[model samples]
Target: MRACTFVRASKEVVDVADVAALVKADLERARDTNVTFSRHAMRVVPVETTCFAGVDEIKEACKPLIEKHFKSGREQTFAIAFERRSNNTLHRTEVIEAIAGMIEQPPNKVNLGDPDLTIMVEIVKGVACLSVVQDYEKLCKYNLRMVAMTKEDREHAKATANGNAPAPGTKKNDEEKPAEAAD
Candidate 1:
């Protein structure tokens, strides 16, 4: 697997190579193996690393870089995401809204979700590529595993699969329950 490193370090555009080297060094310090560098997003500084399990490690490796580069007063949130190219059609706006909602911030206050001043990673061809998020939340939402079906839904699906009818008290439609007996 590949890892992507996004940097929100500087307002002035910085070289991709510098970002890549910073990530490589960080991963090396962590004793990561089989590492390699990948591409970056336009106007975003990112470095790709190879053989990473996931973005968690990539995020850990980036803390020092973030402190060093993104020293501006604006509180910046940096994130990393990974996926195969085949699954890359995630919508950018939806992600921003979800993230904004999660953080309780307005989307516009968060700035354009795309080309977000952070890094993103995608795994393709066995290489971890680094790119910038045009929308920060865009990549973030993909990381959300499908909402686990509600308990009711899971029970229903299980019942159907087992060829059983809904259990008692498991109404198929929403209805006001009968008044409970007085305790």
Candidate 2:
């Protein structure tokens, strides 16, 4: 299976060769082989190295491309999403609502999330992945993973369990203390 790198790029003026070169450079930096770029995405195979440090890096790297390719001299917004399950069924409306809820935006505004934008992603096997979604309704056809709790929430839970106190370095055992002399 070919591994693809999806980039949310600007719809501004761009050169396909430049994009391809950039993708090639990125893959080489990551020590990967078999890299290719499509009109909206990039794909690579035999990914042996790490070219992208994180999602932010990927986004940053593609910002210029997006601006170069999708810029229409109009204010626009967009989202990035990916397809997860290869066999899950999705309802258009449900997907839209889910995205809206996730982004804390109104459902109607999803389509307007980004205009003149295209979804970018790579699919392994039968999987379809688009990181940014302008239309949530389009996402209901895939099986997505459950949203995990934020780091803040986990920390808050631990602190609450510890009586709002910082975590102690070690556990104190009352059992080790002389049994209270049967008081």
Candidate 3:
């Protein structure tokens, strides 16, 4: 079976039926309410092949779907992501590059940091399920508990490093401006 795992602080193996029931109960508990049964994941398996033949096949399979995402409806910068579930001949980097090339608009903008649309590919078993998900935030999100740090901050974090570096959580460190842009 094809599955997509999610990370929760609790790290629970969610049961789909239980989730549905809970949502329904919560919604109905509000008096007048409508509960919509949402489908979250799609599973597909190829009959002939156990895995994609090559990156070319992946690119071709993605082309038609890419059009719907880029060729119609609205125009926006995009990014490609791949989730490989099984051992496959295609290398991840090559897969992205190849598919990006096959996408109709070659010179189209690619926004790694903030893409308006994300072409997400999930290859499970051998079946390839391609989707153009506009809700990219759900796919990639930052953890609230973690703070993004710079190179200097990262270096100082190493246990082997020792220096006059201002220790973390010190009032003096908090007042200091981030070190000048890395040369």
Each candidate structure's count of clashing pairs? 10, 27, 0
Q: Mind giving the per-residue lDDT tens digits that candidate 3 earns over 23-123?
A: 22433332222212223322221111123547767777776566645776455778876776775654678878887786556446777777766666666
Residues 100-176 of candidate 1 have per-residue lDDT tens digits of 34332222234434434544455454344544433344322322111123436545665777878656767655677
Ten residues in a row with the worst lDDT in model 2? 139-148
For model 3, the superposed segments whose C-alpha errors exceed 4 Å read 1-53, 73-75, 104-107, 138-183
Each model's TM-score, in the order given?
Answer: 0.29, 0.26, 0.47
Q: How much is 103 displaced in model 2, in angstroms? A: 14
For residues 52-170, could you state the per-residue lDDT of candidate 2 as single tens digits? Answer: 32343334444443445344555444544443333344433444344334332322123444333323433334433333322232222111110122446535655766796445654
Q: If both were scored by TM-score, which would come out higher, candidate 1 or candidate 2?
A: 1
TM-score ranking from best to worst? 3, 1, 2
Candidate closest to the true structure, highest TM-score = 3
Would you list the clashing residue pairs of candidate 3?
A: none
Measured with C-alpha atoms, the lDDT of residue 92 in candidate 1 is 38
- The model with the greater lDDT, 1 or 2, is 1
